[model samples]
Target: MNAPLLEVQQVSRSFGDVRALDGVSLTIAENEFFALLGPSGCGKTTLLRSIAGFEHPDGGAVLLGGSDLLALPPNKRPVNLMFQSYALFPHLSVAANIGYGLKREKLPKAEIAQRVDEVLETVGLTAMAKRRPAQLSGGQRQRVALARAIVKRPRLLLLDEPLSALDRKVRAEMQLELKRLQHEVGITFVVVTHDQEEAMSMADRIAVLAGGRVQQVATPLELYRNPANLFVADFIGTSNLLPGPSAGQHLVVRPEDVRLVAPGAGRLDGTVADTQFQGGTSTVAVDVPGQAKPFLVTEHGATEAVRGTPVGLAWQHEVAVGEGLA
Candidate 1:
């Protein structure tokens, strides 16, 4: 990672006895794509708002390039938040929408036009520059919002579920588009999202939050392979969390790590209960004798195993999960 560009230290907040953020601390690198990922009511949005100057944290500090960002108001802060709504003016043209911020600062009309034109090309909306928001598709509108935000050349870009409004196909396309735009703009991105796939696919690193606290912060691959604790194991990706022999301990098993063999050859005896065939992979659920929940196994390509087939379940390795990791 590059040198830290944004520092959030022990930030705390409350909503009349409901502690929203509890001593959250994070260091975001310059030009890195960082995600604040969590389920609803986990305070990720609050954290984003705090950084954007929309919500003042009850405690701790926010620093940008070693300067006090908390002291500045929302408009004065060197950051821009691209809301999920893509709040573009219905009556304004694409060029006008992108140039609005420059107009607010009273920049020269020629300069505004130049910047707007640059970003219009950057977002691939040059041909639609004269079109209104209603005249654009959902993805194009999203680009307009992004272009508007980046045209200001803010130091940081905060996005709150920026792709939530689009359909699945467009959302997937926009995910790559967002990464491209981030790299082209060369700005630090702090995206708050509840979608696990979105965070995993786009973010260079992700801070998984839950219950108003950070569960773990790691790259998507690292987080998936080695979760810090039980909560993280249960949250980041799909895991078959089996209770351990002792209390406060659990086994974290990924479906891919599970293998099936003839009965009595592996550790546990079970029958294939169900199979879900995805394009290139088949997920097999096994009903073990003593286990309350079926163990899920992922098999590449089409699996020949069908329901009622007897098999033994074995693990590639054992990962002992404890409660004290946090």
Candidate 2:
């Protein structure tokens, strides 16, 4: 196999007393859309900053194209970071904002203008070039920031919470845009996000982080289907984690995998605590006798089960599907 485009080798960092990145290490392939996913305070942002040269790790090294990346400063490194806020200059026009980095690089006036126009067209904002950041919509502002980052044509682009500022609808739209932009430009993207759905929807592969360590690194489906441990199983999506036959292990059954049946028909029986209608799917929370948390069962369209209804839950046997990843 070919070498990775970016390699993070046992990178470690810490705050005054708290360890932020505990020997974290991962790799990214060329032109891959990769995500660092975890909850707040999980060291994902710290790791991204470290890779961008904004933060230095006490130990270990970061390599870009097999060259030492830590030896350079943020500006000197061949990378650009897009802030969560989109960080567009309010006073500058969209065109100026996109070309700001090029100006600093002392590129010729004509070349900067040409490159800025090319990027504006690439991001589909050619018509809004004259508008200021404040005049643009949230999505437009995000595009300007993206255009600015890519205008420099860096080897790797780091985006910190790129779409967190957009509303649900706009965010959904921009997710596809980001993927399209990445593929069109063929630039390696490393995005940091706490949103699981965002990471799952966009990234080719994700590195799930927790308490400064990598839990598992795999494609979204692989991570969902074969979680490395209880944390990964519970974090990626919903998992009905009941005790397995062996001690200290769990039978990780997904809600979609669960089949609802009459009380006497299933391997386990439960009382329907509640049913939540979510557009095309209904999430039925079932309270089983031995389990502390309700077993969530996903039913397509509308569910027939109501509160207080007794139901049985059965899923495909482990042998029929595949053994849970540990």
lDDT of 2 by residue, 1-326 (tens): 23599999999998998899999999899999999999999999999999998899999999999999999989999999999988788899999999999999999999999999999999999999999988988999999999999999999999999999899999999999999999999899999999999999999999999999999999999888878877888898877777766777677788898989999898899999999999999999999998989999999999899899999988768621224434
lDDT of 1: 0.92
Regions of candidate 2 where Cα sits further than 4 Å from its true position: 1-3, 319-326
Cα error, candidate 1, residue 152 (Å): 0.4
Per-model TM against the reference: 0.96, 0.97
Which whole-number lDDT from 0 to 100 does residue 80 have in model 1?
97
Root-mean-square deviation per candidate: 1.7, 1.6
Model 1 bad stretches (over 4 Å)? 318-326
- Total clashes in model 2, counting residue pairs 3 or more apart in sequence or in different chains: 0
